[model samples]
Target: MTIEIGWKLDNSYVNNLPELFFTKVNPTPVSSPKMVILNYPLIRYLGLNVQTLQSNEGVAIFAGNKIPEGAMPLAQAYAGHQFGHFTMLGDGRAVLIGEQITPLGERYDIQLKGSGRTPYSRGGDGRAALGPMLREYIISEAMHNFGIPTTRSLAVVTTGESIARETRLPGAILARVASSHLRVGTFQYAAKWGTVEDIRILSDYTIKRHFSYIEDDENPYLSLLKEVIKRQAALIAKWQLIGFIHGVMNTDNMTISGETIDYGPCAFMDTYDPATVFSSIDIHGRYAYGNQPNIAAWNLARFAETLLPLLDENQERGVKLAQDAISDFGKLYHRNWLTGMRAKLGIFNEESEDGSLVEDLLNIMQKYRADYTNTFVALTFEKLEDSSLFSTDEFLKWHRRWKDRLSRQQESNNSSQQLMKNSNPSIIPRNHRVEEALEAAVKQGDYSVLERLLDALSNPYDYSIKQADYSTPPEPSDRPYRTFCGT
Candidate 1:
């Protein structure tokens, strides 16, 4: 089938680029290729000819069996501090095909995840299980609906092969899209292995691609560091406000594009506990819900270290500049978190005691172990006396204070209800529900549950009677929910 290939692309990483930035890799052809899903919206966004991908031959290209003419597939190299330990790591199972310039002039990386081994695969298979591949597809889309910046999935193609993990599972490839896959690890890798010139080249490339406004600044690299810090601060604050735990905050998982990357072992906290952790390997709770902001700052510090030479010629001046930028993360995250909290409380204006009022609600929530998502959802309504949510003396006391605080605002009740409804979603991808959906698809050959879940998740704020079950928290039977990296 000669599908008319309409690939408007370029390979900047391979053109006039040092070999150290990446390793040339060709994808291993699968035995049998099958189409699982295609993102029609993204297809139009990338300005691709839809006719080319609807046929069986398109599965071959998506499953990494066929490469487009202008595609230069390669595995990027990077190093990271994984759980406070420095290790050289790279794209072990992912391969970037090319940079697709959209019809609107925005550039994005099109990569195939779980497309077999590369030079970076250190004593591990590069195959991905269908469950985790689907897990990522579901979670990333949910995150997008939440208005968070994140990498998007374009397609998931089945390879008609079995992969051996904890159990033998069907293999699949995820075609992922992102502004860029460059991470803080990339800079670390360049600084550690490449010369100062290499680091400068990377800094320049990052500025040009993502932070173009600062390219002509007197200290463009320093400004770049500041901007990245601000982005990360705001991002982590948003995650905290929404009860999302990244599970793993390793430098390699932190993208310089300011988008959330790597969906492994991530979960939303059902109960409003700051120490909530779902990742099986995070025994110490280093990346817990409460510790995310600190971990993000620590990761940014490592990023700053890689920009020392580019920050300034004088070593002392550069260190001071980096420290000043890193110090702003706390103020930035606090302001961002407070702003989000104020909105969740339906307050249109800020007061000096607003922070304390927000803390009091969360304090009571944690004390009573209330459902995190439902508590805010219930606030948007007129009365809660008849519900199980406000049948406590402690909650009653706080509810009165909250109403008193709201009365001082300059907003109408209808507008405040709408704001609260928008700020607090009625539905989140609960860990137990996600597990159920994955179990049905991975073992039962049924994908209807997942499709339905995605449909319900698309409008999380809307209170639909049919989707009521998705809003409930997991019962005691689902206690101590555990997740793994699926490596």
Candidate 2:
């Protein structure tokens, strides 16, 4: 019997782009695949039939054991500056099945991560472990709930096979949906290796897909660069306002669509330390919480480099154009960050002293080693009496100043509080809680913990008694939280 569910797959990527962009490939089959979880909400969003996708055939498709009709699997090619060193990289353990056209007419790339080895698999097993796949699923969904731009997980299925990492771990495949997988590194690869015509074709295709509004500009490529810069600036500001450390902001991981991709070694900060880094590989803290804006600007500069030829016929003029556009990044980022900080602090109107007021609060938080999320939550709900740090003279003085600043706002006190409530999340995917849930699911085969954690994280801004259960920070005796790439 053939399984069919009216899959609306329109493979624009493979059809519209040149052969140099990707290589045709099929997912390597897995044995005895079992569905671990399914995102019913996402299923409906994509206009997929939920009942059909809940069947065994759907599990097989998600596990890379069966291919769906109209799916054209391929491994994309790209290059990246990993830790500031240029290297060619690509989809080693992932295969883009096809672009699914939703009923609303939006197209999304459906990818199977940990599907198997590809031409880009240099010298190792191109497989993903169960824990890491689940981690991405949890974190990505949490990020989405927080109103952040990110790739989303549609499903996760275990391979029923063990792969050796530091130890034998259960294998799994993640069904990831994204606006597109185009990255800054994709342009780098074309610029460094392919013909000039390849870049032009790619630029045109990208503009058509993501930035079509800019296609009519006199210099569409330059416009594309500026638009990317704007999106990335605002995106990084959002991350900073939430204490998110991407941990690994490699050129390959930075998406052209400005959506957060590749959830490797990413974590939200607990303590209010700007220098916090959770990736075990980030020994120098290059992608620290405070450094994300700078790194984003740096990556955009590299992206600008790829468009140098397209910017102008004269190399000097093109460089200048790219430089001028890149220079706006800091101001753009600062404006976004300041506006967000104002909202978080319950300031309803802009004031000259608002930046210093926000900085003073941060300085107190850092000096007292306060929990980042909780401190904001306290201010949002006026629960500062709960924390002893609020009793300190430095904090008390700062609090008085904050109150004075709030009085100058045009909005009412109630409206200002409502703004803060919306800005400050009551719950984040706490590092310790995430680890606990993963341990139970992976080691004990108990998903109840993971399910419950997901439920608590589903509505981050809603402050409820249930959310408080997962809001507690790690115990003092616990080891420092570290994350892996899970590659």
**lDDT of model 2 at position 413:** 87
Worst 10 residues of 2 by lDDT: 1-10
For model 2, the superposed segments whose C-alpha errors exceed 4 Å read 1-4
The positional error of residue 260 in candidate 2, measured at the CA in angstroms, is 0.4
Candidate topping TM-score: 2
Expressed as tens digits, the lDDT of each residue in 1-487 for candidate 2 is 2235557888898998888889999999988999999998998999898788888889888988788888999999999999999999999999999999998999999999999999999876889999999999999999999999999999999999999899999999999999999999999999998988999999999999999999899999999999999999989999999888888999999999999999989999998999898999999999989889999999999999999999999999999999999999999999999999999988877889888988988988899889999999998878989778899999999999999998886788899889999999999999999999999999999999999999999999989888989879887755678899998
- Candidate 1 lDDT tens digits, 128-158: 8888888898888888888888999888988
How close is every model to the real structure, measured as TM-score?
Answer: 0.97, 0.99
> Which residue pairs clash within candidate 1?
none
Clashes of each: 0, 0
Query: Global lDDT for candidate 2?
Result: 0.92
- In candidate 2 the C-alpha lDDT for residue 205 amounts to 93
